[model samples]
Target: MASSADDVFTAICGGTFVYPAVMHEQYQDIRVTNRDGVTLGSIREITYGHAISRMVSRATEEITRIDHTSRTIESRFKPNALSTFNEFIGSDLLRDPSEVVGQNL
Candidate 1:
């Protein structure tokens, strides 16, 4: 059975044939070749640990860009929402709500 890494390598290499990998070395060299055995490119193995970190970093960057774009689009419709929120917090609404019953008792 081909491992997940092998699948990923095969996909990245544009549907090329992935040669039988040698497992002795610290890294797995995925020889990318066409159907007729023409070498296309070299695929290097990434450890599972490093792959997780790289995936997380990439996801975080994409999420940040999405969040920023959405916030900008929303702000265009409600430009004063943020400032109003800040003003409300800065005002005495937090200190005295006028509905509390007994405070000095």
Candidate 2:
């Protein structure tokens, strides 16, 4: 039975002819072939780890963009609604209406 790392490596390599080496220093043993079955390159053992990190970084960037866009839209609309309400009720509407009711107790 293959280990989890072996499965991950196989999936990334996309072939059954390759094998994962026990020694991390032997990363060069993992062969990568081109479509024409020619040796292209050998990825270092750290390559997979780097790939995963890059994916996480991209996801975080997209999330930040979404959050910033949402806040900008909210800021633009909130002031418009407040201004419209103030205009409808007169600029002094923000003041206490109790003064007009004659209840200065």
lDDT of 1 by residue, 3-105 (tens): 2334543443244222222122212212222221112222232221111121100000000111223322111111122221111111123433122221111
For candidate 2, report its TM-score.
0.14
Which 10-residue span in candidate 1 carries the lowest summed lDDT?
Answer: 55-64
Please state the error at residue 70 of candidate 2 in Å: 41
- Cα deviation at 59, candidate 2, in Å, is 19
Instruction: Report the lDDT tens digits of candidate 2 across residue range 1-105.
Output: 112334534443343322221223212112222221111222221111111111100000001111233322101101111211111111223334232111121
Question: How much lDDT does candidate 1 score?
Answer: 0.21
Distance from true position, residue 29, model 2, in Å? Answer: 20
Off by over 4 Å in 2: 1-3, 15-105
Candidate lDDT (C-alpha), each: 0.21, 0.21
**What is the Å distance of residue 93 in model 2 from its true position?**
66
Candidate 1 runs further than 4 Å off:
1-3, 15-45, 48-105
